[model samples]
Target chain A: MFGLIGRMRASPGKRDELVALLLDGTEAMPGCLSYVVARDPVDADTIWITEVWTDEQSHKASLDLPRVQATIAKARPIIAGFDSQTRTEPVGGVGL
Target chain B: MFGLIGRMRASPGKRDELVALLLDGTEAMPGCLSYVVARDPVDADTIWITEVWTDEQSHKASLDLPRVQATIAKARPIIAGFDSQTRTEPVGGVGL
Candidate 1:
């Protein structure tokens, strides 16, 4: 089980567009299981993402895709910091 | 893979408390894979939760646990609404 929770801060005026791109990117990812985008109710510039991947290898492979890389590049300037933690579920623990 | 994304609304002043309880609850869940809590930067009263489970059965079982049930009861009033979509990954999709 591979997962990551990323906290992103968007440029003051570009938050909504970032969210749209992320949602679109999620739909484009071949290995992505879940790609959720959320906004802070109070601070619209704050963004939250819940990402789920099939496994570490697949997740790693996803980084090489052209569209995925492009989307990331487009977001670099608008993003504050990619505060994320990557973790895994030990085999046999749950669905594994 | 089994996953659920639930949106919770906190009472005017109870948002923080709800986050604490939910975080604690995640630590206690037997089949939980990922338990995440996020706050809307602006609203203060808004909350977002990202939940992952081993499978649907484990998730169902979790709801039957005493502590889990109690937590739900304790949170019903403070919760504005639970807007969650339950979904699954077809077998052979990535890690499956």
Candidate 2:
């Protein structure tokens, strides 16, 4: 499994725009399985995205997509900070 | 808003027990707003918890509670890796 869990700090007065881009851009990527952007109930500028893709290759390809790249281009300065970490885990759990 | 976002890597054979403890203990936290334990659909060893509390005081107290602490003591080696990060954000979202 491939996933991206991270936070994006949007620029002043730009949270809505970034969220819009994400919501709209994500729909265009078939490789994307599940993508959720949850804004902090208290912090308007903070956005947390939990994204899952089919595999590492799909994740890489999604990033290279025109829509994804375009969204990033439109996001630049409006974003204060962006950081993420990726991990892969095996299927099914045995521990109980 | 106060929230705890982190991953808990359960021991090779202890994921169920840990999850049970969390599920049971969280219900006892009056300060808790929301507590969700999501296991990686792909990784059985991975557990992600998104917990929101009233404040730092509540969060700390919850940990000090008998059940919560007892759960931890019983969880030790059963957990392979545990790490977490904390942050606070003001409420309401303006950006759109």
Candidate 3:
């Protein structure tokens, strides 16, 4: 399986709004095993997203979907910037 | 629950060894809900670690444990540096 761990900073007080957009975007995401959006307890403006997909291709494909594209368009302005993003190959896990 | 998402870059060619140590370190960790270590598919020397604990205090306490201290000591030299770390509050998920 493929995994993605990304840290995104919301613009000022837009953290909750960004999280809502993220949670909304997860709907009907094909090939998604798990997609979690969590709040950064220490940094109010930052959020962490952890995703598991069937494969690298599936993840890439999702980016092109209309739903995803629309979500990104909506979330672009609210996003301050991405701090870090790492692509990972998941070995195994309990939830997966 | 508390969550930790961290990215670590290993010394050149030591990614696998570091991953081994991380996996070994998970044994008998009290209050640990989930601990997953994954290889970076794009970057050979990087690894992503996603951890969940009962609470923030439990996560902090794990750092002081003998086993954890020993693991940190053993793994320190192999680690190149940490790229990013975000402390998160997990709302709900499939695994936990």
Best model per DockQ: 3
Between prediction 1 and prediction 3, the one with superior DockQ is 3
Between candidates 2 and 3, the one scoring higher on DockQ is: 3
lDDT of 3 by residue, A1-96 (tens): 888888899999999999988887767777877677888888989888888888988889999999889999999999999998877887654355
lDDT of each: 0.62, 0.64, 0.83
* Chain B TM-scores across candidates: 0.79, 0.81, 0.96
- Runs in model 2 deviating more than 4 A are A83-96, B1-6, B9-46, B49-96
**lDDT, residue B77, candidate 2:** 59
Give the per-residue lDDT digits (tens) of candidate 2, residues A1-96: 465567788887788878777776666575555455666566778887655555768878887888888878887768899766545332221111
Distance from true location, Cα of A34 in model 2, Å: 0.8
Could you give the interface RMSD of candidate 1 in angstroms? 10.0
Interface RMSD of each: 10.0, 9.2, 2.5
Per-residue lDDT of B8-80 in model 3, one digit per residue for the tens? 9999999999998888776677888777788888899988888878898888898998988999999999999
Clashing pairs in 3: none
lDDT of 1 by residue, B11-76 (tens): 888988887776655456776665556665556677656666667788899888888788888877
TM-score of chain B, candidate 1?
A: 0.79
What TM-score goes with each of the models?
0.49, 0.55, 0.71
Residue B80 CA displacement from its true place in model 3, Å: 4.8
The model with the greater lDDT, 2 or 3, is 3
